[model samples]
Target: MQKEAIYHRPKNNFAYAYDERTLHLRLKTKKDDTLSVTLIYGDPYDWKDNVWQYHKQKMLLTGSDDLFDYWTTSVEPPYRRMRYGFYLEDESESLVYTEKGFFTEQPLDTNDYFSFPFLNEIDVFKAPDWVKDTVWYQIFPERFANGDSSIDPKGVLPWGEYPPARDNFFGGDFQGVIDHLDHLTELGINGIYFTPIFKAKSNHKYDTIDYLEIDPQFGDKETFKQLIKACHERGIKVMLDAVFNHSGYYFEPFQDLLKNGEDSKYKDWFHVRSFPIETKPLPSYDTFAFEASMPKLNTENPEVKEYLLQVGKYWVEEFDIDGWRLDVANEIDHQFWRDFRRTVKQIKPELYILGEIWHDSMPWLQGDQFDAVMNYPMTSALLDHFAHETISVETMADRLTSLLHSYPDNVNEVAFNLLGSHDTPRMLTLANDRKDLVKLMYMLQFSFPGTPCIYYGDEIGMKGGADPGCRECMIWDKTEQDTELFDFLEELISLRKSHSAFGNSGSFHFVSAKDGVIQYKKETTTETLLFLINSSEVIQSVEDLSLSNETTSLFGNKIKPNTALTLEPFGYEIISL
Candidate 1:
């Protein structure tokens, strides 16, 4: 470590983990000087018999603007006491290491066997470790409600113009939700996932014009405080959509660089190229992965990193929010998250950070970064199984097997299992108002490994499809509400909440996959519950069912399966013992 070189995490002492097969290794210097970094994995304590020397591996290293990024083989060779280091390839060529009665004239190998010891503790946020069995709900605020109208915006932004249709304010602020906390409380959800309340342009505030400011459309700072207080009072924690991957076209940081061009004080704030666009359809820097509006920021830039990190810390310090739902998380630089995680935990150790990773998210969940992901996988499963009827029992079995194995055992605990969201249609329409299948999915949602997040309208049997359609207003009129569906959902939640073990203590095991009928059991040390579902159109005669004698069905219906438990079409049950 040099006195002049600057690094994002300059204190030097670091701790890292490789959660899946993907390995992203990075080292920061005090300054942006010409330097080089190498990664080696094996027994850092012993290079015994040359067997400890790991070689013949594929590696990648690239430098963009200033920061250097690279990856290496992620093979864990059952070795203990593994050490790695960074060596600056400057003219001076200094080697960095923990001092313990040792000296190096030149850059020393990170895994160079040493006798003396150097010790310091570093805590890496392990994901899926504690969240695999919990369920989460995702909510879009504007559509959710205008909890408080006193704070609604009276005017629009100076540069805002969207065909007069895209008004930023929609009366759905945090305080509005405070007016109706019981809407979610009745569902027995442990947390609420709100999209970016941070200042933005569009209705679905993905483009973070200002990370620090809460969108006026959603009320001001104080309103958020009340919302936080209200939710916390009711045992429901809150996590907001963290849109750090990109910024709105009008974001001050980006706008400044655009106006000042190369002479801008923050010239290196983005991935500048030789050709602003090389043509039209793609502007200079006004795109994400080269689109048109969602411009990607250079997270590798020091200034940019500092700004975003501060914003994340602001929420924790200002509102005591429980977690963050990072948007477009996969597209951003991995090192940035590593830094973000460290900075956030400094404010609150229990801050849960879930990424918007639609893929397997195995790598992200491997005890290193995110606590969970918006379970698009679970959503797709529910859609395919209940709607399209394409997912068969065996196919489901195979998918679940691979899903559990994809990440470590903890993933299912944290995955937010939503039947539908504002991004997609409500389950009512998706299920075509079948009531039966919807109830079945609700049972599965709560019964499954992850936390079940009920979209505000979805619980009351709201219906719609796709973006604008899915993002409909909440039906405040519970008078005409689908009481049957609502009651069934309550049963599922009550069953999980009443039994301490089922909350997260139980392990899921499939009992039988007969035709379209799927049966599974959730059991912890002190409790046992059985789930019986028939996804088929025909009634099922499930014989020798794998359930216990002591049964209390959810929806307050207690029944037994003596003469081959008969499932009326899409019948599903959450029976407890």
Candidate 2:
């Protein structure tokens, strides 16, 4: 028994309220060290005569990584209050673990057990229920499609003629998005996350000059209303970007400050360091990443707070936007976001608020702020295992397990999982243009829990490096696109939407991983899906799979029940039982 490897805590992911009535508990032990674990729990006050009343339920081995195995179970107390502890057994020893410490035998006193005094409904983390069912499609508007050449920005380059650069713009507009509604509908995405459509100076639109107006390069107010209406009619929810973290250098207020030193009426709107602001060798005032073109806002100011709060409310109340993907969310103050959530949800209670946090985001995800954040950690793990091949299957599994266990289950369900976006290299490019490796990457992404996003052009096998390269013009011509890859992705999306087990409605666990072959299972109440992937150059076979004869193949043709299966290099099979 590896006593030192056993771990559990009373808060956070280790112990959390799954809902108003149910509490989730987790325990970790050295990998494969524990044969079984039983959760012995009951209300601490439910004592009869001289004995403390309790019940014991066996815990399931939910997931494992290189160094640890995680066991979990859900329990409901009649009073929504309970004290609990674990009874673990290994091959050679058995022990009882409690909040205080390990015990050679089960303790008679309920005082020594871990406690959940009360399960308050208000404390449970509840994101929008609709978010888990969404399949997001990220669109960089300027390069998607030019529906209105009449509204083209001056000096716009011909679509798809030149490689994308920092300053170049193609005439992509709201009408363009409306024109391509069939593409998104056929591809089966329920959510459209536009990068930034608000009036801004740069092609990317992160440097916002006006928070309320739709960029003319895109369309007018009425045009945007029509676009949203069209999307809603097609069952697609619309999410716009909010760049409140900074303002463009040419913003009216910022320009006034630049022209009139400290005496300007808008002096307190930003973090101005000196009387005369300079954008030379170093910005005279604090900026976003030291870029003089983007000045950080003074979120703490009373007037600034009202202005931004109104901006946050205007879209949801007037334009009927379904969500807001906050830009640089972590850099802003927590109070601002909490208020932002209140303001937006007031207009639409189910509105999704996703943040652009690239690191641990528990602080902003306590159910009072953003509902979810862009899942960058999962992207890095997939890239390392599938694209870069820098880690073994076991190591990758371990990393993934750790990430999953780092958050409450509710948060995990709605996390914005993506392989590529405007901020990173395309998955195909990251895999050195290896189609097989890219398929494997998407397989894991769709199978894992969370809302998955498809970067524009990636569905058609687009390839490019980071930034300007990844932000290439979308390919619309049938002859120029990789239809085969598109077909493969379309099938995967269909499977995900059709099966409850393929998305957040199920629980995930690795069934087997050896050599270059990996197998995992996603199980729900009514269905089970088993995926076998071969990531190596050689063929692989599974001879001991215990699937029953009733199992049906959901993906590949050769897979059958209770039989050996063979996978060619980079091949995959999804079977339903």
Candidate 3:
């Protein structure tokens, strides 16, 4: 046994309350090193004489990545508190692992075992239930449509007439979104995540000049209210972007600081390095990435915190917005977010709070700060394998397995998963314009755990490069849209919503990743779904799927129980058993 590779802890993902009564525990060992693992646990005080009374339950090998195998099991302690340890075995020997260290035999002292003090129902990570079932559509308001051209910004270009630039605008507004509600409904999107619609100088609206008012270009507060009402009437939830990390150059406080340096009462609102603020060369203050125009706010300041908290509360209390997608959330202080979560959730207990974090966000997702973050790690891995062809299928499977084990099951269930977004290249562009590859990527995204999101024009096959290019105007002309690709995605969204085993309710596990083919299964209480995708250019065949007699094909080719299942180049199959 590789003792160095064995590991466990009493908090976070390794051990957590899955619900009010159940505590989920996990143990990790070197890949293929341990043949079996069993959980030895009991209430800490449940002891008689000198021996500690306990029960042992076997842990299932839930997943294996490149370096580790994860074993998981659930326990319900009668007293709601317990101490636990793992008994691990390989062919050669067996060992008892506990908090103190490795032991030749199980320890009778409760102190030697890892302790879960109590399963507090309040500490359980609970996101809004609606988020798990939602299929999000991310709309960059400035590029979506221009329903009321009368409110068009000065020098606004004709829609889709030219390639997008950072400073250019096409006068996309709330009315534009309200006018085209049918597009999203037909696409089967139940949640709309709009990029910043607050008053700002740039088209992207990340640099906020005013948090309480809607940008005039997007219409006033009344128009936004109407948009929210129309969306709710259609059963679509709305999530607005909040840019509290920084303020635009024209933001009043920032403007005052630029003018009155030391005399400004708002000097503490920002992080100014020197008495005289300068924007040339580099600003004398902290800014978002070194951009002088976007000054980072000192969220630790009491006034700043109060103002932002009010901003969070005002939206939910007045407009009835369903959620808030926080931008650059990781850059802010943890306490601010904790207060933010409490303030907004108090008004609307089910309001979804999503953070725009691009990496591992376990610190902020402990049922305190954020319900979920933009799942960029998963996005990068998927893009690298399917779109860029930089990683092999086996490597892709390993990366994905590691990602799933990084968080609790509930966190993964509501994670904001996306392919292309306003920040990256379009999926088609990343896949070198191969529609089949894009479809394959979508297939995996929708079938995997968590809610799936689509960028504005990705379903219709709009192609662009990064940043400004990715923010192209939505293609409204039906003749120019890729209806075939649209239909494929529409079917996927429907499958995700209609089938229990095909969505977040199911348990996911990898079956195989060999011969350039990646296969996995999503199992529920009553049904199991098998998904097979050929990532290679050549056709692949699997001879022994070991399907049951009652198995049937939900997609792709149908085959007899013992027949070799052959898939075409870049092909896929969805089997139901």
* Candidate 2 per-residue C-alpha lDDT over 1-577 given as tens digits, one digit per residue, 9 for 90 to 100: 7889999987878888999999999999998899999999998888899899999999988888878889999989999998989999987889999988899999999889999889999889888898899999999999999999999999999999999999999888889899999999988889999998888989999988889888999989999999999999999999999988998998899999999978899989999887678998998888999999999999998899999999999999999998999999999999999888998898899999999999998888888899999999999988998888898777777788878888889999999999999999898999998999999989999888899999999999888888999999999999989888888888888998889999899898888777988889899999988888998899888776666665557864655666689889998888886
Predicted structure 2, TM vs. truth: 0.96
For each candidate in turn, the TM-score is 0.74, 0.96, 0.99
Over 4 Å off, model 1:
1-137, 153-169, 275-280, 289-291, 546-562, 575-577
| Model 2 C-alpha lDDT versus the unseen true structure | 0.90
Give candidate 2 misplaced runs (Cα > 4 Å).
Answer: 550-552, 560-562
* Poorest 10 consecutive residues by lDDT, candidate 1: 6-15
- 1 or 3, greater by TM-score: 3
| Model 1 per-residue lDDT at 390 | 82
lDDT string, candidate 3, 1-577, tens digits: 9899998999989999988999989888999999999999999888788778999999999889899999999889998999999998989899899999999888878999999999988999999999989999999999999989988989999999989999999999999999999999999999999999999999999999999989989988999999999999999999999999999999999999888889998999999999788898998999999999899999999999999999999999999999999999999999999999999999999999999999889999999999999999889889999888898888888899989889999999999999989999999999999999998899899988898999999999999999999999999999999999999999999888878989999998889888789999999989888898998899898778786664557754556787788889999989886
Checking candidate 2 for backbone clashes, the offending pairs are none
Better of 1 and 2 by TM-score: 2
lDDT (Cα) of model 1: 0.65
> Once superposed on the true structure, which residue ranges of model 3 sit more than 4 Å away at CA?
none
lDDT to native, each model: 0.65, 0.90, 0.92
On TM-score, the leading prediction is: 3
